[model samples]
Target: MEAGNATSAAVLQARELVKRFGGREALRGIDFEAAAGELVAVIGPNGAGKTTLLSILAGISRPDGGEVHVPQGEVGWVPQQAALYRRLTVEENLMLFARLEKHEDPRASTEQMLELTGLTERRGEIVARLSGGNQQRINIAIGLLARPSVLLLDEPSVGLDPRQRARLWEFVSALASEGGTTVIFSTHDIQEAERYGGRLLVLADGEALFDGSADGLREAVRREAPEAADQDFETAFVAFLHHRGH
Candidate 1:
């Protein structure tokens, strides 16, 4: 309850998280944590409940069982897509969301966000006109307008090019460095996780398979299954699944 020391206090924590859809269990039980200024990535294969876990943390959906504790002003969410109005300009969309949230300085924040997202030149362009990568950038900027201490990003690099993805991660790292924002993002791209995430959580069947540094995961794979050492993330992930089953 007492968030430990100011430096080490966890911005987000979930224990034994579970979710069900119809008769099937989407999440068995998941435990995750994000400390201040940490950039953690959630990696897993399809149907592994990565998105489901992120949704619960983002407050977009509730978990069937388990506890999620986040302090006020300590959370923000960037969904997979832009979620912007197709007819509205980028600036208009930001203004609309800010006003809906009843933020004190919607206009100023909107302006700042436009600058931050590199959308100043295209602020008046309809969201539908922007490229996919730019739209995603706007989505990230909108999420940050509230200046949350923790940020949850779900598959942010899905439609981005290599350059755009690199730029986005750079921005995220800068945010973490400057504001000490704890970021937890779900990624299918293992290379992206290796390059950007300070810590990695590999999930399988809704359970944490690995929770530690990327280097630690590599070492574990090497120790447990040497054959997977040369394989890429997807292959290694599959190997992990097979090894866990046997």
Candidate 2:
């Protein structure tokens, strides 16, 4: 759904997006938009096409139908898999990607990413030798090397411990709220969606079911299952899906 009526202000937009894998459809006529400096959470159960939607937005995949409009060469994508050169050190990996992205002054961008991602101390360490958290940090730092206007992360905090997850959120939240970068991330954690998402776009079976605030989602759940009016966010979401026969 459209985040707001101000479509001209949106930095990213997908209209009637459709994707299919073999006989099974992944996304169906999904319309989405995100304005500058907005933190949008893409949440749904497994097989909900959350990752598919992100891939399309990040320009990593093309939709079979519809269109996605974003500034060319200004989108950052962090997929579920680590896209780093394992044999290379953190600094080297950053430099390589910077050059690949044709970033002006690869050295300056590499150093900035190292410092911004708090990997300055570990810059010389091989990516294969770093912990999961540190590696994820490197992945994100590389995505940010070009100073993208829109950042798309698919399950970015998957393997991190609680402390690491907390730190990751702190950095991401500030990036959107203070740095004016549009951030869109997908996750199964409802609490994270409500806590970090300034806007939420929920998809089920490749269809967008809801798009708005956490409280707005609560109301949608309440309409679907009035008995769940007082239910917690996670429970309410489950009930909403169940009531819809999804």
Candidate 3:
């Protein structure tokens, strides 16, 4: 995608975003934007409000302050788990979600989705019987059943092994490449973030500590604090946390 084209295709924008949980503030004046076909990762410490930010973006929860503007009919959401019905078959689960979204030809679309996720052979199998990776694939398929323009995932690779995680990344990358879907996800794995994310958003104490490409982040660390260059993302992340006093 050209720079101008990407900039023009901003699918989701959050400005001065804030979320409060009683006495605590989860997101504090956060600002974010995702362009068409861009893959961005939101990285933060345990309580840095990554989930809260994703929830508001997914419309699963509301924010206490700020504005979230997403183009109508452009957003799709996949939560942490493949929350399919254990008793339902893979095909059945996809069709059900499609129908719930008022999609036409849910059956056919479900079949196509199965093929896309490499679950065609297992379409008739019960979700409960599928492996953890396969089940998560179904979860992602259901989220994409609507053919959303903007895809939001909350720790989509949380419980999977290395191979499963890699497979999921491949699927997500293909989706963005082919469909121009703006993808945003949160992950605790810095390696995953480095490998998969086109851009990075580092949050600490509900504040954006870094907003740029992964390379840019590296450069920032090298420029601001040279000692962090040899460390991996986890260590660098901790350095950021400590430096920020979070």
Candidate 4:
């Protein structure tokens, strides 16, 4: 489905989602909706509950309050850390995840993901020998095997070079545009959100501070300070956060 038709249905929804880690509240009631074919970037400063929110969305952790509407076993989650079989070949690692996911045709899925990640050429090499970027690619491939309608990722580009990062974003964009997989990712890179995120969800101090497009976020910041028209996105975003006392 094209992005035009993506808005027909909401693939995920968080109604007052809340989470508490011991005494600290990780999420203070987050509400958001995700369309079936859009890349929604969740951006925030450190310790702003971005990870906690993704955990809830991925069903890895239960929220203390509120509700998230996502079907069981229909979500692909990639944590910041790479989870791969370092001793196995790239193809073998993908196959391992495919079987774990119980994909109807694990081999076919592995082939598709191998080609998708551009790992087909190096499929026979051990994962430990691959560069950090290639390992990250394999980590992403493992998540893609779930054939999820909604894919959630937490800082998947931590160690990639510029080219690798570009390739990864292109791959994700294709999934959202052609495959209609709703992609929700968390990032501290503000410019990334402005560049690739079709929609943006800004969290601060365990609360949702803004939810809209990059232009919308800029316009929102501009409303508070007309002098910010010339500033870059990072500057404007910090100003916006400062305004909210985050």
TM-score rank order: 2, 4, 3, 1
Against the reference, the lDDT scores of all candidates come to: 0.82, 0.88, 0.83, 0.87
Compared with the true structure, the alpha-carbon lDDT of candidate 1 equals 0.82
Listed in order, each prediction's TM-score against the native is 0.92, 0.95, 0.94, 0.94
lDDT of 2 at 13: 88
* Candidate 4 lowest-lDDT run of ten: 1-10
Expressed as tens digits, the lDDT of each residue in 1-246 for candidate 3 is 101112565779898999989899889998888898898988886888888899899888988899999877768889887777999998889989989988778888887898899999888899999888898889888889868988888899988998998899999998888878989999877778888998888887788777778877766666655577588766766775676677
lDDT of 4 by residue, 1-246 (tens): 001212548888889988897899999978888988889999999999999999999998999999989967899999899888899999999888899888889899999999999989999999999988888888878888988999998998888899989988998899899999999999999998888899988998898888888878887888765666578768877877887788
Alpha-carbon RMSD of each model: 3.5, 1.6, 3.0, 3.4
- Distance from true location, Cα of 53 in model 2, Å: 0.6
User: If both were scored by lDDT, which would come out higher, candidate 2 or candidate 4?
Assistant: 2
**Between prediction 1 and prediction 2, which has the larger TM-score?**
2
Worst 10 residues of 1 by lDDT: 1-10
Clashes of 3: 0
**Candidate 1's error at 109, in angstroms?**
0.6
lDDT (Cα, 0-100) at 83 in candidate 4: 87
Best by lDDT: 2
Task: Report how far off residue 199 is in candidate 3 (Å).
Answer: 0.9
